[model samples]
Target: MAMVFADPEMLDRLAKSLDSKAGAIPQLKSRASALDAGDHVSGLPAIASWLGDTAKDLRRRANILRSPSESPFDSLAAFGLPPGVAGDPDAGKKFQTELKAILEAQKNGTPQQRAQAVKDYFATLSPAQQAALAATDPLLVGNLDGVPVNVRYAANRITIQTEYTKEAAYLATLKPTDGAYKRTQERVDTLRSFLNPRIKSYEDPKTGQDMKIEVSRQFLVFDPHFGSTADAKSSPFPDGRIAEVVGDLENADNVAFRVPGITNRLDNFNGFTNGGYQLAADPNGNERPDSAVVSWLGYDTPELGDSVDPAKAFAGGAALNAFRQGISVNLKPNAGLDIFAHSYGTLVTSKALQAGLTNVDNVTFMGSPGLGPNINSVADFKMPNTKFFAMRAPGDWVSYTQGHGKDPADFKDITRLGTDGASGHSQYYDPSTGSLANMRRIFYGGDAKPLTFTHTSLDDEQIGAAEAREMVGFLHSKVPPEIVVKMGGDLDAAVQAHFAGRTGVKDLLLEVHSVLGKYNMLDRVPPDEMFGKINDLAGNVAYKQTYKAVKDKGAPDFVAAAAGKAAELASEKLLGAVTWPVVKLLEVDRIANDAKQFGEIIDRGTAEIGGHVRELGTELGREGAQIYNDTKELSEGLFKDGGKVVLELGDTVIRPWNAGQNAADIWKIGDDAKDKIFAKVPDIAGGLNDVKNTVVDKGGDIARSAAETGGKALDKGIDIGKGVVKFFGG
Candidate 1:
């Protein structure tokens, strides 16, 4: 939790410590250096000696035991008096007075009060302090030329290692060394540890095995210019030629996809050969057979400061499509796929979904400023059914500086790249603490311990949850196959409808299909059982047809009424199957407002197909009656066997979807019987025409209904494809 500032007196006490003096440099000539004279180890002693004497430096510097070599600023050149408060005089006086009081409160304040006092001091310094601090630390400030830029941390202003000793001297003069200064010094160390990056190993309580994690060292290439492929035949691949690391074929269970951001060319591809292989190599120095990571450095864009050009189609999407095609050539279905995207790589994720590639599971984003507002939820950014993860350390300044005035939904915001948003743009390693734990948890489940400074721990569960939601959610990206088939069917309809001037219907179908396809009925389902269920259902249909036909024949005015009733029943049955899922899916909305709005859409689709099927059946039955009557007049023998007569009449008067094939050609049939039926029906044009129309109409209805229903479920599962082009169509 962040500290709040309300107390003025407490802030004054803290102000006293802000102007403390630096301690004298240690006398290294008197003590023996702790090195064995080797070049690598020779400098260690002198560095250690300087760290021992910096306790009296400015509050920020004193807290850090800096070695001379590691000293960010040269002592003589960088040291300066605390400049008089530069902004508002009245506010400065109030804060200065409050700062001293806060120092006293540190000795006698409640935890809450003490926390508030800390907040007050930081609040007064905020934008100005941040700028000043960044001005001094080379890591934080890109270029120093009169003006200072405030490098933001996670909602806090980090202290810059400056050369001001007056701030250090003033604090030492007011309070004893062991009093407030000591405690504040300890807190400063804690803050540093929280922000520092480190690789650590810990014993897992669950597996009781030592687990190791390294906070990745982030490499920021400041504008390594890469021109278009058309202009340059070969772009420089950065770092070096990458090693094969873990071969794609070796990872039977894992598949990795890498996305390089703007101005990427050869340099971005190093992860595939070097960084990826290094990570894939086991501690014993062998390649793991279950995983492989691939780098995708195929994209084009303007420089960092430029806005994304809307007119141009980004190359990453097409590259991913090509990659998917190549991968499918050898990879088994359903392998877990992880996608790593950095900076502009996030925009590639959006395009991947727009294209037809599937089976993505995880996506991770790093060094991104913000993801656009259109991507309000993780679902909006991922493939129909993929998990997404986002990682950023506090030290990375791009997350804050990039896209400052742009809309939250603009692609300029990299955080939106995750299924769940990654909040800040940060260096992956600086401030070895905080969000690093979240990134580790995404790759290897469970908490990573926060780096401890002298007095505090920096990382916590809240940040962990945000990271987990983004990463783990990415793992769930691939919707189950059954759901996909259904969604795909509906998507096909949407595409067809869109081109045919049925945009409204297309929109509805898209919505419905997306949600319905997500329903996972596999918990206890066996693939082999589907046929058996269909068989049982078919038998029930046959029994009802026979029983109703007989009962209707014995009743008054049975002929016309019987056919009408049967047509209505078929429509009801078809509609019921399709409509039920829609209603049920919509009910999820009532339980939670965020529930996907696809149910009603699927139901409407069911109705359309159901009504079509019923109308076709009715029309066929009417035509069948006319054929039976006309044929009977030609020859009484035609009506002799009622079953044969009915079959003949149905074939001639009904036209069905995919009904051109003879009975023998459709389902399994006896060769002898198949021959006899075909010979007897030779030149029986009317019967064949009738059945073909009926079958075609019914088949279309079923395909449409299934597509609508399945698509909706899948959309719900992945939370994508809602309104499609409509949302951004213009």
Candidate 2:
């Protein structure tokens, strides 16, 4: 019933303070009832709200203070009937009379007087009336009527009591526990064996331990509709195909399982003709003696390159769903599993993970065409601790030309796949060579050393190597040597330097030409043609230029005479060369000073020539003897200690490379034109000899005089620059 608050201001303040706008009207009524009954201070609106409708919802939900036999509020917020109404409108007069009685108790009374008045009013009701009143007003049955008129003022009269049930109360209750569930599972497993039987176990010949054991609940070859096999007695799935695989898994632990792609077989519950176990076998029937492998032919699909039927989609999902359901139910606490999915099997693995069915440690995709369009985040897949790895070999046709929708990383975002230059489609199992080492790192985890391939095939050793490499990756091993060599400091610098020097070789050839011509050795070519040949040869030295030889366009007699003067120039140059022969003297001094250095230079140069010969893929012919004789004659002459004849031979053979380049360009000009170029080599060396001996024999007097004169002339040139600057004074 609505109990109006006597103080409007107090009601307003209590409503604002509690932030309970919905409960404000009811709270005001509760405050008025308490004050009218002389049970609380009317002035304390905040405290009244706590004991009013605001608290009603809280108390109903707790049900702590409710009598065991009475109904609590319908909802936490339910309270008494509205103000101005009771059980019926005709009873308003009766409600008013009752209200006045409660209001009259607060005035002119002791604490005991008010308390007794409240108790006597409640005591007036008969047991039947009390029962009816209790249903409508639960607070009345709990002695709430006689809360002391001065209860807020009396510490001694106020009483509080509580009751608690003992351990026996909750002990009778029920909930599930791990122990019971596991025990129940044990019973179910025992019962399953009666229906399904062990089909086979792959044993290791060396260790004699069953690596992968298979079992089927039924041995029936079901129809495409999953109906009974023609031979009911010999079906693969006795209880069910999925159930038998679940039994095998529950019994053993494995590092990884290979799920093979499509192969047609009917009535074999697991699609026997093409399955995981069959695919893992060495194609040539060679056993992988080093490791255990299983080709999982569990996936259902049409043969490779065959179009998919709409009806089979549901079957595919169902088969995967069955395996997932079984694995989830029987997951061992400590064991982790790896799955190798090749080709169409990748699709199955992808679905299983996406559906949250399989709990796998790592998943590898080999020879995969596609997974899905987008698998960007970890949340996109269903399993935990799952690693997605794939490999494509160099010779794999698919790798060479399969259309990539975008850049590899972007394609990964779109297709949810990953590929590296080293990891793209290729051989994943042939350890003899190729990407198997890299795949091994992704799977088994191990170190990769020098791997040599004799034949291209993905065999057991290669598979073992790839798995081992994957194992090493798991262990965080060091990278391979080839990677180190390509990326490291010393080798990188050497490669750069070697290439740069090669580019400069042609320039050095041109520099030798200028030095030869400075000694009046212009007989190297007919004067008119020398300039044209220089430009022609320079073109051939680099791709930026194309060399074209000038034909014999009828040379003038003067040009022919210049070309024919080679012998005269060689003789005249020899007179000067003989007077100053320090090049010959120094050669003698070096050969006498150190025989070991001489031997090493000769050995190293020969080795360098040998390597170049091998690279050109050439063979020595009859002309080889001429080259050997030229080399021996030159070496013997240069090796001598101070002989004029040897010195002369050494100079002719060691002509400037630039002059030789010019000579080569013009050698086809004519017979006399070629001889003049050959004759210029000795002319240049003989001229240097004339000057060397002139200074040597005279105790360096002539050289000293010339140096002093040159210094004076250079000083005079500096004075001239200063004079010119002053003459133009600003």
Q: Which of the numbered candidates is closest to the native, going by highest lDDT?
A: 1
Reference-based lDDT, residue 654, model 2: 85
**Consecutive 10-residue window with the lowest summed lDDT within model 2:** 155-164
List model 1 lDDT by residue over 28-54, tens digit each. Answer: 322333444354445645655444343
> Model 2 off-target regions past 4 Å?
1-248, 266-296, 304-318, 328-331, 376-384, 395-730
- RMSD in Å for candidate 1, one decimal? 32.9
Give the range where candidate 1 is weakest over 10 consecutive residues by summed lDDT. Answer: 235-244
The local lDDT score (0 to 100) that residue 475 gets in candidate 1 is 25
Regions more than 4 Å wrong, model 1: 1-245, 248-250, 267-274, 278-287, 305-307, 310-313, 381-384, 401-730
lDDT of candidate 2 over 266-348, digit per residue (tens): 32323322233332233322323323333333345533223122122234544554433333323334445666665555555
